[model samples]
Target chain A: MAEPLLSIEELVVDYGRIRALKGISLSVGQGELVAVIGSNGAGKTTMMKTISGLLKPTSGRVMFDGKPLTGVPAHRVVKLGVAQVPEGRRVFAQQTVRDNLVLGAFLRLRSGQKREVAEDTERMFSIFPRLRERQDQLAGTLSGGEQQMLAIARALLSRPKLLLLDEPSMGLAPVIIDEVFALIERLKAARDTTLLLVEQLAFRALEVADRAYVIEQGSIKLAGSAKELLANPSVQQAYLGAAATH
Target chain B: MQTLQLLISGVAQGMIYALVAFGYNITFATSKTLNFSLGNFLMLGGVVGFILYMTHNWPFFAALAAVVLVGMVGGAVLLKVAVEPSLNQRSAYGWILATLAVGIVLRNAAEVFWSTDDFKFRSPLGDSPWRFFGEPQPDGSMSGGLGVYPQEVLIIFVSLAIVAAVELFKRRTVFGKAVVAVSEDKDTASLMGIDQKFVILFSFMLSTAIATVGGVLVAPITLVSATMGTVLGVKAYSASIIGGLESGFGVVVGGLFLGVSESLTARFVSTGYKDVPGFVVLVLLLLFKPSGLFGRAAIRKV
Candidate 1:
């Protein structure tokens, strides 16, 4: 309640004439892991994009660190300590794994954190050992799960105060999806950063989230503690079908 | 010996084309827009270089530096004036025409403000050819065994150096990787905090600067004229298409192929038909491999 790190007030975004987010409001406290779970076309990615400044809301406010982030460009948004791992693990496919990691720390590198970023990169390699072994290979050659790790690691390199993970389990095998969620859980336990995860995997998301919001038809349908939502029969009947959306 | 002489000449000529083609590649790689006025930027370089080094009697290196500055500035202006507006509107054809119009205006401006007549640009290395094996004549000149112009050698080395430097920069530097990232995905690039607009602007500047320096380098052989970029620009575009717009080595290969064939055709077939073979190859090549000889066909994602 004491000035959340990110707060959206009646955010409305549109795709041309079609309204994507009619009016949505959410808030995430410092060091909190908040999950927004919804079906496809439920305005989850749009909301993430709007928060990260990839999309501008029609008539709403996005405040980050108590500063207005309504119309800031996406590039500037990253500079303001918010990074989004966009849906589909859109890695720079043409470049090598190491190059991708270096690019992840692009702003910091320019600000003279080359050695620090390099040390952080070594840390990423340690966390995902496959990345170290395949650092010289083009990122496109990486497995979907590896690519997801790379995406998250790359976003982490920016050292964002708030991280937006849009469907981290998307397009991965069920086993791999579990691994990704486990990694997300590990990050949560570390508690070095705040995270807002937009996911179609409602049950998995709720399991990891400290708090959760259910969005449907461009609006927030439910907002409560993850335990309460998980216990709620309506939430289970609607979205606890683990394989339904995938 | 005649073949060898023709080969060097062809390669040198090809490098000029390759250099300009490389310019096209840089901007296209980053922004997916070809700087249509690249040749004119080259012309701008030549004209400026001529004024400084030839007419004003400035030192060659000083003139070269000035030409490079002008080229960089010209590139930035082209991006801001012609490229950005259309891109913002999301009109695909707008940039093509905008750049073309700028090129036309540039040509007309040169003709009106300067001379329309072609002027021979004296090479800093001087006018004489470097002979491999020749008889010394009474005029203290070697009589034709194989005569390679000093300018031709300079052109080959300098062009290769430029291409090599740029390729290395893209692979080795963080800023360079950011440019590549922007090219791959503009939106994703911004997520990494890369100002993609600045990357696009930088691509334009680098593209134009390279083209301009090319003008200065090529002028000694081609002559400086208001309309010099027109045909040369078309040919360079062809070279880019033939090589693969994205491949650095491909452009050089395409340029060299065009250059050698042109030289050989002029010697064997006819001077009037010299341009025929390269265009024929380009047509045939496109029919078989549309992306270009070295171009990778992108696997489309939904």
Candidate 2:
């Protein structure tokens, strides 16, 4: 079998005294969507940040496309075809939407791919047409859902082989959450992009993910096909809350 | 006529303060730290330009170019030596002391090399005053006229031009946009593949180069001295705070307002009380709108 696109082995991360991720391991094959679902404070965000080189892991090895990601700076990680839409959609508030999209292709810009960057920006506008209407408006003026779309669009403009999205459904209405997930689903179907999704909304994430991992209190408790996890009685009780006595 | 002269001089002086304040904004915006050595950098520009032009008989433009290049390198060195080390320690006030120490050293070096006495810096534009709107006095002498120095006009023109160019760079270029991105959120900027360290270094270089330009322009009027940057730096800091450190245009407005107030106070009250009005306005502005007249209130994100 071909090597997985991303491989994490026994990753451990600590924030001072508190251990955030304790010996967690996961992998995603080429063109696969992997979901890691857990409640808040379960270290989901920490794991994602560690993988994208935002946080330094205490002891671990992260191999992305056969390169070690550990100790590498976050900016250099993007050049390795890995892009992350960080939690809370941290868009440049004072900048225009178009500028945000353009900055997303900063690596390409630095390499003197001006024409390609412009073409990629136009491509992003097509993917998120709402952005086209508000292209000139400051990203701060955008609504939560619109900002989320802008963040996703900005990440997509980087043209990454692997995309890590941390809590894309965060702080949006249910309808907007569904819309965002639908957009991700469409992206997966239309492109060969590998996705590592960290989400608190287990059911929604499991519905679209090809494979799933259940992380609780900084460690993975279960890993299997998404369909299998959804049907598992324990998962239904813990995450779905279907068999709760209360 | 007297009031108009004061106003014109006030505007010219304000432009110098605005230029210095704008330099403060550049580094502060990028790294959230101010280079206290900024004034020393300005002194270097004036002193270097004077030496190259007057002492060595170098062309004026060549002297100016050499000063700018040296200042740029000095700024980068400051970041590496003073800023990066302090930041690495994660201590907020460490950089304050580090940069302050660097400033003192630079001032001392200049004092040793150029002496403590002030030196006249000849402007490339001749010292002859251009008289405008003259009206004959009762004794058949020109009384109601404006005496404008060519260098003063250049100061005002260059101030506006620098501000406009920086504004344009921030809006139009990819590198400029990277700067904006890093300023807004460093983590997100890194995710976009921007090296935050490089941006910070670039801002320092830009800031120092700007201070050098300010020094060169004002030296003709103010005289070149090792310690000249001290008062100018303090006033520029006040200007930046009064206008809102985050807003470029606000700093200019604050600078002009402070300048006009200082001149008016000097004429109406006493020259000894000239600096008082700027401090008074700064205090009043801080008491009321701490963000500054044109500064935007920071938005809190959960």
Interface RMSD of each: 1.9, 1.5
Least lDDT summed over 10 consecutive residues: which range in candidate 2 chain B?
B293-302
- Clashing residue pairs, candidate 1? none
Pick out the ten consecutive residues of candidate 2 chain A with the lowest summed lDDT: A237-246
Candidate 2 residue A59 C-alpha distance from true site, Å: 1.6
RMSD per model, one decimal: 1.5, 2.4
**Candidate 1 error regions (>4 Å):** A242-246, B136-141, B299-302
The sequence of per-residue lDDT tens digits that candidate 1 reaches over residues A100-140 is: 89988999999999889989998998999999999998888
| Model 2 C-alpha lDDT per residue in residues B104-146, reported as the tens digit of each score | 9999999987779898888899897777789866885664488
Off by more than 4 A, model 2: A242-246, B135-144, B300-302
lDDT by residue (tens digit), candidate 2, A118-224: 88788878878899999999898899999999999899888899999999989898889879999889978975789999988888889999999999999999999
Indicate the DockQ of the complex predicted as candidate 2: 0.71
lDDT for residue A18 in candidate 1, whole number 0-100: 96
Candidate 2 falls in which docking quality class? medium
lDDT of 1 by residue, B68-105 (tens): 99988888888888888988998978999999999999
